[model samples]
Target: MNASLSPLAILGIVAVYFAVLVLVSFLTSRNDSNNADFFLAGRKSPWLLVAIGMVGSSLSGVTFISIPGAVGAGGVNQAFSYMQVVMGYLLGYAFIALVLLPLYYRMGLTSIYEYLRSRIGPHAYKIGAFYFLLSRTIGSSFRLFLVAVVLQQFVAAPIGIPFAVTVASAILLIWLYTFRGGIKTIIVTDTLQTVCMLLAAGITVYYIAGALETDFSGMVRLIRQSDYSQWFFFEGGWSDPNNFFKQFLSGALITIVMTGLDQDMMQKNLSMPNFRDAQKNMLLFSIVLVFANLLFLCLGALLYIYAANVGLSLPASSDLLYPTIALINLPPVVGVLFVLGIVAAAYSSADSALTALTTSFCVDFLGMRETDVVPDTQAGTQVLEENTKRKRLLVHSGFSVLLFAVIMAFELINNTAVINSLFKAAGYTYGPLLGLFAFGLLTNFRVREEVRVGKVRIPALILVCLLSPIVSMVVDYYSAELLGGFQFGFLILAFNGLLTFVGLVTLSELGEPHGDDFTGTDYA
Candidate 1:
C-alpha cells in the first residue's frame, strides 16, 4: 500500500530546488557583491520578505519534522502544550520590538555585539561575539545534520554515497549560492523556501486526511476528542517539564536570548531600512509562527491517527515518525515534498547562519566595516576593498568547512530529536549572552575588564562568563535531589544567566553615568 521515491528522483528534485536558489543568488548579487550588500542588504530589504523568510528559518528542519513528531512524543512538548511557549514568544517579541529594536537601530549597528563593545567593554564585546559563534555553529550543525540523516537514509544509501559526501555536497550547495549574495540573496531564497515548506506540510496533511476518510471539520473533531488534545498542564507543579508556568516562562526567556540576543536572527531584523519596519516584521512573523506551529501539531495528531487506523508500526525514534510515514506509507509525491520541505527548512536557517557567522567574524574579529568606503577612483581604497573582500570570501569558505565537520560529528554522536538537543545546547551557550546583555541594559555598573588578583591580571568578564555556565550545569544535574525534585528543564538558561549576572556584579563598581551609557531613554 506504500510507494516511495527513487534515489534518482529525489536527487532530481533537490537539484532543481538548488538551481532556482542559485539563479536567485546570481540575480541578487551580480550587480552588487560588496560587503554592505552581503552583510546588511544595504539596509534596503523589504520587511514583508524578511518576515516570510524568517518563518522558514525559525522553523528549520527541526520544526519541519521534530515538532509534529513531538505532538505524539508524550514527553516535553506533548499534545498542545507547545502553544504555551508560542504565547510566551508573543510576549518576548513585544519586548524585542519595544526595547531591543530601538536600541540597535539608534546605534546603527552592523554587528549587534558592537553594542556590547560600546556599553560594556572590548572584552565583553568579544565574549558576546564568541558565544554567538559557538551557539550558531552548534545550532546550525544540528539542523543540517537532521536533513543529512534523512537524505542519507532515504536517498544516498540507495545510491551508495557515503554520509560524509552527502553532508559535504549539501554544505557545498549552500556555499555556492550564498557566498556572493549573502543576506540579500537569503531574503529572497528563504521566502521561496518558506512557501515550499508550508506547501509540503499542508499537502501532506490533506493526503493523511484523505487516508483517514475524514473531512477538515471531522479531523478537527477527532483531534479535539483524542487523548493528545490536552493543551495546558497545571497539575504537574514545579517538577513537571510540561508545567504551564515553567514552559511559558522558559519560552519567553528562550525567545529573548535566542532571537533577540542572537546575531543570526537579529541580522535579518537589522537588515531592514529602519527599526520600525523591523518591528513590523517581528510582529507579523511571530503571529504567523503561532499558526504554523499549530498546523504542525494538528498534522502530528493525524499521523498517529492514520497509523492506528492502518495498523502501521511506529518508528523507534519519534524524529523518524513523519519521515517514515511520508517516505514509506504515502504516495511518491508526498516523499518528494518531504525531501524538498526538509531541504528548504534546513537551508533557510543554515544559509543565513553561515552568512551571519561570516559577517560577525569579519566585523567583530577582523575589524572590517561596511562604512569604510572611499571614492571609486581612489586606488588605495580600491585595494583595501579588494583585500577585505578576499578576507570575507576565505572566512565564508572556512565556515562552510566547519559546518560540514560539525555535522559529521553530530552524525557520529547525535541520537535524540534534534529540537531537544538544540534547545538543551542553547541553555548552556546562549545563557552567558543573556546575562551579558541584561547586565548592559539594566545597570550602570562598569566591570573592570582586567582585575588584579594578587600579582596576576585576570580577564574578569571572561572568567565570569566562562564560570557561569559550568556552575549552572552542575546545579542543573543536582537540581532534582538538591531542590526536592524540581526540574529545571529549559529554565537552566535563566539560572545560568542569573549566575553570570551575580558574578559580573562581584567585579563591578558603580560609576557616574557617562555620555555613552545606555539609559534606556537616550534614543527616545
Candidate 2:
C-alpha cells in the first residue's frame, strides 16, 4: 500500500474543496434573492439537472458505505436484492407523478404538507410536517454520522483531528454550501456532487477490476460463477424476510414514504416547472437510482475480490469494508476519491433535509400559504410577504439548531445497529402520511372540523402503524422457537405501512353528508 500523501495533504485538499462549495453557494444564492429563490429555485429548474441531482440525493453516504458492506453479510441474494426495492421505486414514482405531483401543482404548494392542510385539517398538516422534521432530522444525522465514522477512521486519525471536530467540520461545510439558497443551490451542487460520487465509485470499480485482471464481461462471468449471484426470490415463503413479494411490497412502500410522501424528496419534485416535468424527473430518477445501485453492488463484489487477492484483512463490519480497502490496500488517490465520494453522498442528502425541514415548518406549521391570492396588487401583499419572510427565517434557523442537537445526540450514542433500526422505524412514521394522502386522493373522505385529536394524534397514528408489525413479529418470534428460527428484513416495513393504511381507512369518512364522492377535481 502506498502512503505517499500525508494526512496534512488530505486535510488541505478537503479544506480547499469546502471553500469552493461555500463560494458556489454564495454565487447561486446571489442569483436570486427571495424566499422563492431559497426554497424552490424559483421553480425554473431544468429537468435534466433535477434528475441528476436527485440521484445523489437518493443514495446518501449510507448507501455509499452500507450497500456495499451489506453484500458480504447478505450474500449475493440479500445484497443485490435491494435492487428489487429500487425497481419497486418505479411504482412509487408513478404514484408521485400521476397522483401527488398534479395535486401539488394544482394547489401551488411550497411544501407537500400543504396538501395535508387542504385535505384533512391543520392538525393533520402539522402532524405530517412534524413527522418529516423528526424523521429527516434523525435520518440525515444518521447518514452523516456514518460518513463521519469513515472520516474519523481513515482520514482524521492519521491527521490528528478529533472525531468530533471532523464531524462538525463536515457538517459546517454542508451548512456553508446550503444555507443561502437551500434547495436552489442544492439542485446545482447536488448535480455536481452526483458527478463526483459517480466518478469516485466508477474509478474505484475500474481499479478493482484491473487488479483482478478482469474486463466487464470477465467480471460478469466471475460474479455468475461465484457463490453469491442468486437473483430470483421465489423460494422464500411469505413468512420469509427476503421473499420476493415482501421485498417488492416493502420497496414500494418505502418509495412512497421516503420519496413520494416525505417533504425532503417531494420538494425537489415540486420545484419542476409543471406536473409533467416533475413526473419526468421522478421516472428518470427511479431509473437512475436502479442503475446507480447496480454499480454499488458491483463495486462491493470488486472490493471483496481485491481484498482476497491482496491478502488484506476484511473489516469486522461490512460498512467499513470500502473505506478500509481504500485506506489500507488501495493507492493514495483511491483513498482521496473515497473520502470525496463519502462527503458528496452525505451532503447530497443532508442539505436537502435541511432545506425541506425549513420548507415544511414554514409552510405547514406556520401557515405561510399564499392565502391572499388577489394578484399581489399592493403594499398589503408586501406586508404579508414580509411577515412570512420573518417566519421562514425563524423556522430555518430554529431547525438548524435542532439539527445540531440531533447530530450531537447521535454522536454520543454511536450505536450503528440502533441507528439502523431507527431508520426502519422512521419508515413506519411516514406510513400515516402515505395513508393520509392516499385517502384524500383515492376517496372523498372528508375529515370534518371540530374533531380534536390533540397532541397524541401523531403518536397514535405511529402506534397503529407499529402495532400490527409488532404483532406479526411476535407471531414470527414464537413460531421460530416452536418450528424453526425466523428473521425479518426490510419487508417488515410493508406490513407497518399497511397497518397505517388500514388505520386511515378506519378513521377516515368515506362520503360527504350532502354531496357526491370527491372526483379528484374538488381538490384540483
- The candidate that wins on lDDT is 1
lDDT by residue for model 1 over 1-524, one digit each (tens)?
Answer: 13347888888999999999999999999997889899989889999999999999988998888888888888899998888888888889999999999999898888889899888878898999999999999999999898888888888998899999999999999999999999999999999999999989998999998898889999999999887898999999989898999899999999999999988899999888889999999999998999998988898889988888899999888888899999888887888888899899889999999999999999989988864566666887878878888999999999999999999889888777788889989999999999999899888998876888799999989999999989988999899999999979989999989888888888888894222343221221
Off by over 4 Å in 1: 1-4, 374-377, 452-455, 513-524
How much lDDT does candidate 1 score? 0.89
Candidates' TM-scores? 0.96, 0.88
- What is the lDDT, from 0 to 100, of the residue 303 in candidate 2? 77
Q: What Cα-based lDDT does every candidate model obtain? A: 0.89, 0.72
Off by over 4 Å in 2: 75-77, 369-391, 417-423, 448-488, 508-510, 513-524
Question: 27, model 2: CA deviation in Å?
Answer: 2.1
Q: Lowest lDDT 10-mer window, candidate 1?
A: 515-524
Clashes of each: 0, 0
